[model samples]
Target chain A: MIAGSALYQTAVELNRRAAICIPEDARLAVGQLCQRETHSLSRYVLEQIMENYQVAVAEQRPMCADTGLPRFYAKVGNEAVVEGGMVGLEEAVRRATAEATAAIPIRPNRVHPLSRKDQNNNVGVHAPTVDYSFEPGVNWLELTVVHKGGLFGGDYRMLFPADGVAGLKRFLLDSISEFFRRGMSCQPLVVGVGIGGTKDVCVRLAKEAACLRIVGDRNPDPDIATLEEELLELGNSTGFGVMGLPGDGAILDVHIEIAYTHTGGMPIAIQHFCFAHRRATARIGADNSIEYRGNPCWFTPFYRRESISFQPA
Target chain B: MNNLEDLKLREVRLRAPLTEDDIRSLEIGDVVFLDGVLFTGREGLYSQLFDLNLQPPVDIRSLSNVTFHCSPAVNELRPGEYHIPAVSATASFRFDKYIPLLFERYDVRVIIGKGGMQKEIYQSTFRKYGAVYLTTVGYGLGALYGRGIRSVKDVHWKEELGLAQAMWVLEVENLGPFLVECNAQGRSLFEMANAEINQRFEKLYAGLPQPKLKRLGEVTSPTCEVL
Candidate 1:
């Protein structure tokens, strides 16, 4: 059985890693963007961003003070056993979040929506939301911590089938125009588009696409991959760069995730993962051996399977 | 595309409690680094000082003339002592209403934050007070900015306002890479950038069809800013 203590320890370390380290994929993408960025002002901003990333890791401090909202994604092996079951696992995560908040000194960003009461520990009702998915076979549990800024760069709309790709492109442009001006969304962003599904599902997918996926990863489906490329090109073609300054590129990449939805509606949600791009992941084996990596590897084929039954090859 | 070596931006380093001439000398797009002192403030401090009309516990002007829209990631090593590991600016547009009072009451000459206030506010409040707005580079250079902070001189209203919203008096040196978004003369670099970007929107959106359903509060004009 995987001990609760191990889970707690791993969770705390993941939070620290997420806070201080700019993942390699994101760092490389920014470095490449810096080279390609043409505008003098935007290029300077990109260079500063890269310098900030290096300083964060070297100083062992958070890359951004807004540590955003710290949250988790867990992928469980079907046969994995935990010391305290699901409740035990959740308790460990909650406890770890509070501990990491104090130790890493991440801003305690959580509070009561109405009363605005802060516990001063980044722990509160439904704070540090933990989302779970399962794999067909395996005996390890993987966790990914993402600290995404809560304000700006997210939107949802219901489009009819008649609206088609043209309408989708318009919606993408609308969201960009709304937030990209004045650099409200903090550009050189990863644009995540979630298409088809219930409203909530699409929103969740958009956030996952933005936060969970690495810089160069693409959807396995050919059609979706093509759309991702098209959107990436379109988003960068806007002549907006970092801080909405006139430049060659604003978007780092576009990730699209789809789910089956009602026949009449083609619901869509979009989320922007900013230049900060903080996320980290780890896997805990049944033997309690832990291995950390940059990519979350969240979208397993089984998780996206259309078939009712999942088979492990 | 210009070569990286060919592009050069004018960079300046200024000390706090700046004079009218100091503020006036700055122009839009000038990169700046700050020294001396600045304090952190946001909605909580604004609501208390402006909305509730509470007198500052300490004389506001005595602390510094520069104010930052930020909350650092702080650790209280012991009671009454703190360590800040990182600092970054929050979006300033949301606090636009308080700018006039801040300039009038506190004699604030420099406002540093993420993004910036609406363009008209620059022409009105900022121009009236001979103030300028500087935006943090990348808007998330928390560690780089944090390194500049020498000490947390004082913290106000931690119990009442919570850590993130409390008034933090910080002493900083070389604390920036901030870009002048709005100059003393009221010209906004972002507004100028927006004007150029907006000119391309029509062509970019030409081939795309309008949405099937329109939202009530959405801004339809490509040129109009949502803020």
Candidate 2:
């Protein structure tokens, strides 16, 4: 079994560190998307991105909007057991959420779906945007941060009338093209395509797909993997490159996750995660020793980004 | 974003028994060059410091230091901008309570941050306690790098929230040249758009509820024991 308190502490420290480090590249890409002027300090998208970042930064908090529909993907082996052999994801997420909450000081961004009301921190009986559960394995506890911040500008239900796979592909490609041709002020957007029976699964899966890839990585499927390459070419062909370069290779590194379903109807779920994908951690050892990897950079930019004025409160 | 090499910042510690030069010389746009031993203590840290009633892990009262109004970053990715390992959870509201006490007990010179203080902080603390609050653009790294900050004075803010141990390197330069935000003074481009939409919203709605703050880092907690 792994240590608890102390181990949790160190991990918390690293999580924070990662959040700090990860958001910069994402912000820079925003600059590229907006095609910021080279010398105009205030005119560039970087300034607006920075302005957005500062709100999060000065507040000394996270900038990610969706915070993802979180699901703690885990694997608790036989080695780790609860006091009287009681165990589960509820216990894991609760314990882990508590440790992370204290360590990351994560603002309670969670909310209830039905009421559209915020839970703040109480993770009450109501469901959350994040779903943390179990995986049978061992090693005390190891956690990963996966968030698909909702930047739909509206709701996920707003879809283009699903007409199965063939028609749906047209709908999907068009949206990707619109995002690219229009020149996104937000870039390095992780696009996840979820294909399966139900809409919720595909949508949830799509958001989760973003977490599947590391910052500088790609997708894992073969057939859809080919589609990813094609989508990548189409997006890059639009002349929207890394950071919005006319010559950038790919506008998006697309990832597709799929599950089998009946032949009658096909549902596609698409989730767009901002480039500022953020995550935090806390590792505790058996000795009550804690190493906290709180928020990292690159998650939400703060320092000298392109600035934008705010509306009067 | 300028390269890390391009960004320059200076760090200095704080001291008490205010001198005329320290008080008068400080103004709206002057850049500071500081270096020496200083420590961090917002409300939380301040309480801890008062309770501890001794030189804690870090040194305070040493004029040899400058306290940044902005949060310290973990590392530098570029000039003016750096990798902030943790989000420094400092809200002026929280620290205002302890500033007077901090100045009274310790020698603090420069405080760096956005919207430092109003007449209340200045009249009571700056004038009475021989202290002044400096405004580093409301929210951005440009101010940190503006004028010219060279580097960290030493290991600092090791105890505050948001990546306590991560190193934040500050640089100095022309921040105004790099960023211009939509602020109270009505400078941000965003304000223009938001205002237009708001006008329409106001007409269509009444008795609207206030918008709440949204943030990330909400759920990094371990996944549930079961799905």
Fnat, one value per model: 0.84, 0.01
Clashes of 2: 129
lDDT of 2 by residue, A16-69 (tens): 443333454455545554463332221232444455465455645444322334
Model 1 Cα shift for residue A230 (angstroms): 0.8
**The candidate that achieves the highest lDDT relative to the unseen native structure:** 1
Chain B TM-score in each of the candidates: 0.95, 0.49
User: What's the DockQ of model 2?
Assistant: 0.03
Tens-digit lDDT track of model 2 for B1-227: 11211222222322333354655544332334333323333443555567555455544543333454333323433543434323221324336666666666666654544333433455556566445554332122322332233444444333342223222333322222211111122222222222322333223223222112222433211111000
**RMSD in Å for candidate 2, one decimal?**
16.0
lDDT of 2: 0.40
What CAPRI class is candidate 1?
medium
* Whole-model lDDT values for every prediction: 0.90, 0.40
